[model samples]
Target chain A: MKDWEKNIRIVEPYVPGEQPNFPEMIKLNTNENPYPPSPRVQKAKEELSIDILRLYPDPTSNLLVEELANYYGRKKEQVFVGVGSDDVLSVAFLTFLNSKKPILFPDITYSFYSVWADLYRIPYERPAVDENFQINKEDYYKENGGIIFANPNAPTSISVDLEFIEDILEHNQDVIVIVDEAYIDFGGISANSLIDRYENLLVVQTFSKSRSMAGMRIGFAMGNERLIKAMNDVKYSINSYTMNQPSLYLGVEAIKDEDYFRENINKIIFTRENTKNSLEKLGFDVLDSKTNFLFISHSQYKAEDIFAELRENKIFVRHFNLPRISNYLRVTVGTDAEMECFIRSIEEFLLKRA
Target chain B: MKDWEKNIRIVEPYVPGEQPNFPEMIKLNTNENPYPPSPRVQKAKEELSIDILRLYPDPTSNLLVEELANYYGRKKEQVFVGVGSDDVLSVAFLTFLNSKKPILFPDITYSFYSVWADLYRIPYERPAVDENFQINKEDYYKENGGIIFANPNAPTSISVDLEFIEDILEHNQDVIVIVDEAYIDFGGISANSLIDRYENLLVVQTFSKSRSMAGMRIGFAMGNERLIKAMNDVKYSINSYTMNQPSLYLGVEAIKDEDYFRENINKIIFTRENTKNSLEKLGFDVLDSKTNFLFISHSQYKAEDIFAELRENKIFVRHFNLPRISNYLRVTVGTDAEMECFIRSIEEFLLKRA
Candidate 1:
């Protein structure tokens, strides 16, 4: 109503999962890693100097890119560093989508996709997934501005295979297909391997899950040099020093400590197995989860009622209030002890409802 | 060039100020705090556990806003935080400027202003500063969308009075006027005082200067509730978690340590005075500095020539190849030993030239 002209305010802003740091609550709302980032992260912190805080971070994030390239068996130009995975994805929308072509993404995946598309004033379409919630590769052969989806898709842990993604890229040469591998370290094979073969494919991954550096806010993408270069062009126009100096050192250190990454992810997978079995035995319909979280609902009790009941017992779980997912509660897997407490609390809540 | 979009190619991006971390050859090129940040920044670093790194940063940045509001005596809604001043400025352009209104700034101020204006396709008029590089307040009374400039303007350290700023705001009721106080703590009064009276004034400041947390990347803006709310809407639609966690804690700690801030600013002012005196005695025309830097040049030596000569002797000072500023070198006031070395090196270079 005032004189200022912002973008078409059609975007329903992405609300992050609640972070209730309540005293002595068994919390599992967001899919944060159950363990610390590598012990190397602490070493990096110890070596950080007040004096070094005067210098800007390397814009290229050269050292982290070097490490990531080695891990993926690709050149440094194939990788682009951003403040977070969400930051990387936003840049991808601008780099890949244009007014000439419409963006294509899953109808039931990350809500942030629509928000970004709207913000850029780019037209977008949502191609539906199969009944099993898996990406149908055949539906994406037409001309598109870009295609993006979360692997082991959010609120529905259905992952698309790297082989299928490559097949899509093979048929659709003109459009960029972004394979978001945010939860890839848990189970799904990353399209990072196919990045050398497919110029149109960009694999976006995060340290938030496997390396456990979410609060530090660093994310990276791997693609062919041309695609990565295009993203860089957009990024340079925005905040150039996106990653601050302390986070730069921490990110490099996190990547270097592969043993810690493996150990922590293995622990989460093991815990997910245990939690999944317990939920199924409790007469809950839990989908097979390859992520650090599970999508599930009870047949008798409504998901909303169960969520409210769990909160009464000082336990938290994520329930999206949308037409597609209002009946399900997506529960993040925490530490072994935290999971056990969460399971017990849920059992009590559901049993009382029954 | 390949398929779509425009003006992205052939963009001569503005190079950020030098980071220069390799043993820093007298390190006066960029305007970083010569001294380290508050010791409490280190304390905050120590207090961080790697376990917390797995979680997302609070998107609202509520705690940092509270501390900033308390520091500035403004309501929480009157404050806004960003990754750095650059992030704040970028959002300002996106939020305030439209296709219909003209953005205005000084022609000879921060070079990034034009870069951003071009990036957003926001039409802007750079009202020329006076001959002595002073900001004439009368020049800004024109009808405009938003007015922004670094107070104690960059390159040349001339400050405009806050009284003049209040007058402009009172007259221009519907428009937004941004006062960038990037260097205010060193000398000039912040337009923060005028925020209560002028609903239109948005004063942007950063921790990069007096707080000494540049590498940590935190900045803030103080304005009326409505103006800040519009800016926040833009920020949230953009990057939600604008500040990284450790940087947020570091900025909070740095601001709370007023004694440390005061001491370092005093030392910087002392060094600036001494450097200006030495430059004047050496037959150089030094601008009266209110910042931790000096704008100086000799009548005999071309600024570009001296810049090259100093680099050969492993010293660095910044010289812009822009209009009306080609003859002067912007030298950051460094440590006493660093300044002595710079003087000796410059004298040697001059003697060799003669």
Candidate 2:
């Protein structure tokens, strides 16, 4: 206990959801898309000649950057790619959130925001999400080092309008504002279109949810040239080869297949609405969810009991043990059939408890 | 033009070697394996079902960890894998190199060492390598936060024996010592066998050089369980899913093929010896190389000139403009035929100079 481990880093690390390999398990945790990647991604994998892996990937991820820039109608200098949205946000935190003042975010947003602020020793303030799980725009107007939040906030499954986001950006002219739009493709309006007007805005999106490439780990940020340059400096300093050859190749293919991407997005949105109606019928208070997941809590049935019961029935959903959200369950909208089974499981659990 | 970008990260980032996508070029700039990956890696790629792209990769890289643990005869707790060795070293810098004192490494070791130290604001000192391109064990015995050096160091292509490495580890009981063995399989002895003896020692290796998976971006560190735990904490704090699914699946396949690995390593070693001899016959002062590359300088010809001439002939070699190694050319040992072509091209350039 008294060895050289004293100076080493020690933190209560962020725990990811369980990735059980059982075949019969219904996994609704971690907010992954229930659809496979495009046929082009499969084609890319099929045509991949293994000989090319002997060399290193392009350090700048130029091709992927070009594709992302073209997709968003931004210049190549405005796009920066990373291993995932986590990587993009982590690097962004290090690059833009370094002022002496404390940065600001919603308390009930992505749990990783505070973890990242702590890891980088960047001072931060998490103003509380209101009782209805909405971020009050005035709280972000105060002085801060920088500002970052998921567009459709995690766990709460709520989306803030772009006009309010622009108000925050307009107030905080001297600081960077990162809009982590990880779930923006799932019916939420993107802050990317505001990049030209707001030089400090960085809109990060991931292929994990919308394009069904969570296993590939590709995400990117679109912002002003100067901000993207700062991010690149930090990224190249950290790891030049953040994205691998296969991920880069498949990412391009995935981006090109717009029809397949939209089809899955529509399916997820449709199921989310149906799931919301079904949960309401089951006496659950479902939040207004714009994401691929729905946050719900039943007044009679404790979320802890339901989570346990669902696990026993081989149905898994995320239940946070954190304060103020312990009673709520963030359920990823799976296939229509999976949601039906999930609803049935919840009904059985409630009946047994009654 | 003045904005919030002033306090942001402004590092003079490390520039990696060129990755020109030319079909006719013999690329010997970066130290890539001349041979392809194992046939099993190809099989893994071919048999990979695209359906799994819907789910996130195992955050802990459990199966790949198991394969690497089994291969190195270490426990799973002792192995920490990352996107690349740069990511591993960067995380290790954050984890173990947190003391008040400055960490120590050779002045001309891996260039990324200084970049990482600067990126994280970790204090570091670079002691000069001896005239024979060797690391003196006594230089690292001083008071420091940590120690790291590439075995068979990059661009210099010289290696220090394990006893010297052990001597530094033995002397520095209170600090972490990282022996980056990126090129160890090219005849240099690995300090991995000494992991059981020294709890303070951390051995970092990569699939880039030895296993021919540079495009896949896989690397790992083997050390004490306590240190690995600390690293995992920092890694989890930074980004949980660093390695992608394809990298994880194929990395396991690459590790299971020991014969394919050994055969390619032997081939690179053989070509290295032959290349060194050939360079010497052309009046170049070749450093005794233990890696897949040969570091040579010619008294009659400047390295910059040769680098340009080689590029004109569709041959690329690394030429550093840094202080100590300004006149040197770090030539990656390519296939026998590529080396022959390289030799003939060098001869033609010298003949033209005459």
True contacts kept of each: 0.48, 0.89
| Location of the lowest summed lDDT over 10 successive residues in candidate 2 chain B | B1-10
Q: Tell me the lDDT of candidate 2.
A: 0.91
Winning candidate number (DockQ):
2
Q: What DockQ would you assign to candidate 1?
A: 0.52
Query: Considering only the true interface residues, what is the Cα RMSD of candidate 2 after superposition?
Result: 1.0
Clash list (residue pairs), candidate 1: none
Candidate 1 local distance difference test against the native: 0.81
Q: What lDDT tens digits, residue by residue, belong to model 2 across residues B1-354?
A: 567665677889677667887878999999999999999999999998999987899999999999999999999999999998989989999888888899999988888999998988889999998887788788888888888889988879888888898789889888888999999988899898999989988999999999999999999999989889889988999889989999999999999999999999999888888888888999999988888999999998999999999999999999889988999999999999999999999999999999
Clashing pairs in 2: none
lDDT per residue (tens digit) for residues B322-341 in model 1? 89999999998888888988
Q: List per-prediction Cα lDDT, in the order shown.
A: 0.81, 0.91
Docking class of 1: medium
Give the distance in Å from residue B194's predicted Cα in candidate 2 to where it truly belongs: 1.2
